[model samples]
Target: MIANLLTIAGTDPTGGAGIQADLKTFSALGTYGMSVVTGLVAQNTRGVREIHPVPAAFVAAQLDAVFDDVRVDAVKIGMLGTPDVTRAVAGVLAARRPPYVVLDPVMVAKSGDRLLAADAVRELREVLLPLVDLVTPNLPEAADLLGVPEAVDEDGMREQLADLVRLGPAVLLKGGHLTGPECPDLLAMDATGEPVRLTAPRIPTRNTHGTGCTLSSAIAALRPQRSGWPDAVADAKRYLSGALAAADRLNVGSGHGPVHHFSDWW
Candidate 1:
């Protein structure tokens, strides 16, 4: 078995997102996968219907259980829905201090459903974001964290990237949801002091569920095994684009569907 990469996120019963996507991503990229679910989400590819958070103590215990035994090379975090939940995740991270932490500030789902509590958004900024090594926020999420409303355009996207970088960790401003046909992603950090913009042709389809979780987890898993962050992202971008293209042939849920996790595995 390959060594493990831990995913700390919510559970999606539909197997289209959250910890499900993260695990699939880790497995697809040749790693052992494990999960510590902070919340149980009643969700499909369409949207999140309800969320029931796991008890804070149990969340702690789950984290402790995994970190105690497995040598987790990296971690990918998503959907800590409450301030208390975020705090519990923080406590676990503090205790384990995994080598690489990739935070996918998962505020909204693919089908326009909000995944984060407003109070927890603030807590993520104050408590969680600082401790992470990398923070991947989509355009709208970057806008929300930076206190701006109109980030649907390119100029607005770049401004929000800078604003998010000030919050502590390196910020990866995902521009895939933007209007342009070409998806341009900005990797902004203090060390670079300039946005490493990666532009790719946007794939046109509605079946893109759990993409953020998968992408961030892929980045988390690949970044450690590979040398360069930019290269890792570039390679993962190609991988995900292929996954999305492959998504068109598969059928899952009724709404925005899932990418094919086992496209190359078989």
Candidate 2:
């Protein structure tokens, strides 16, 4: 059966990030996509001007509407803007227990705008982290979660990953923020020979608005089809690299635009 993917995130009217990017990613990967908007942002590629969060009860209703009929094979969660919203999501996921879940710790935007609330971080750690199959966080996010100085180099990243893996589920430490010619993301799993390193040559581009959203969504899309976590991570990396390489093709916003979701297609 074809996989059905759901994105529980905020709405980005620009279509570069959030629910829009996630649905586009699911379609590009040949999976059926659905979405539940948790918040509405007022801004474009430049930066987030304002965020209007949905009521937690309404968010629960939306999840019930989706799960009542559709059999969600995988779920990609992003940008739960408040502590109440996080708790709502946690309740639903705990009850349904979807087969695969990828949590992208979307604290800050590519434009350096904060998405997740400061006080809500604790809720995300205590409520959501343990429920997910995998949690993907950038260097800054890892530091924020672990309450440490940011990871600067390869050594710093390794040290942070060691502490991050104990937080909850398996961890994927993103190396994009780290200055390097090659972008390497580390996956820390419980299996033997853990901490598999996945690397790709850096694609120089300013149009990387939604790279994180797209990567995590692609991982969720491929999870049901791939053999295991490593394979899914590898495939997601390749997909994201292609999208990044072709990002310039899309002349969307003046600032950081989106990666080409249909790079492999038309």
Candidate 3:
């Protein structure tokens, strides 16, 4: 059966990040895509200008509307701008638990703008993190969740992973922010097993706008079809790498542009 994947996130007018990016990823990966908008963002590859959040009650209504009818195989959650919105999403997920849930802790944009508020970070960590199956956070986001400085090296990343998994979900800690030729990602869970490490050579490109959103959504789209989390994450990484490699083929914007979500097809 084709996986029915849902994305709960904000909007990107440029179709490079947030709900737009998530939907594109779902379709590209051979899944039926659905969306529940939490906020409307006015931005492009260059930067974010304005944000208008949907009401918390309305956000719950949207989730209810979907769950009442559709069989959501998996869900990918991104940019919930406020604490109220965060709690709203968590409330529904706790009630009607999906088969798989992937949380992309989208705190900052590729253009260096803040997408999530400071107080909402606490709400995400407390209410949402425990409810999801997996949480994907980059270097700075990991530090923010743990209330510590960003990890500078692999050792630091390993140390932080130990603490993060204690928060009640498996973590995919991305090491792209570290200055190195290779971009490594670690999958850590509470099970008594060694964490899986996957690394790929960093693709040289300025157009990496919606990488976080794309990767997390790809995992959600693939998880229902894959045997386990490790395989799903590995496949998702390969997909993102292809998109990044083909990113330069398209002319999108002046600043950090988007990866080619349909690189394999067109």
The most accurate candidate by lDDT is 3
* 1-266 per-residue lDDT for model 1 (tens digits): 46579998999898888999999999898888899998999988777888898888888899999888889888899988888889989878877788889999988888778889887888899898888988998877887787678577778878788778888888788888777679888887664488898888888888789889888999987877788678778877877888887897888878999988778865
lDDT of 2: 0.93
For candidate 3, lDDT tens digit of each residue in 217-253? 9999999999999999999999999999999998999
In model 1, which residue pairs have backbone atoms overlapping below 3 Å? 207-257
Candidate 3: segments with Cα more than 4 A from true spot = none
Residue 229 local lDDT, model 2: 90
TM-scores for all predictions: 0.96, 0.98, 0.99
Return whichever of 1 and 2 wins on lDDT. Answer: 2
Deviation (Å) of 11 in candidate 3: 0.5
lDDT of 2 at 184: 85
Candidate 1 stretches with Cα past 4 Å from truth are: none
**lDDT (Cα atoms) of all candidates against the true structure:** 0.85, 0.93, 0.95
- Give the winner by TM-score: 1 or 2: 2
> Which ten contiguous residues of candidate 1 have the minimum total lDDT?
186-195
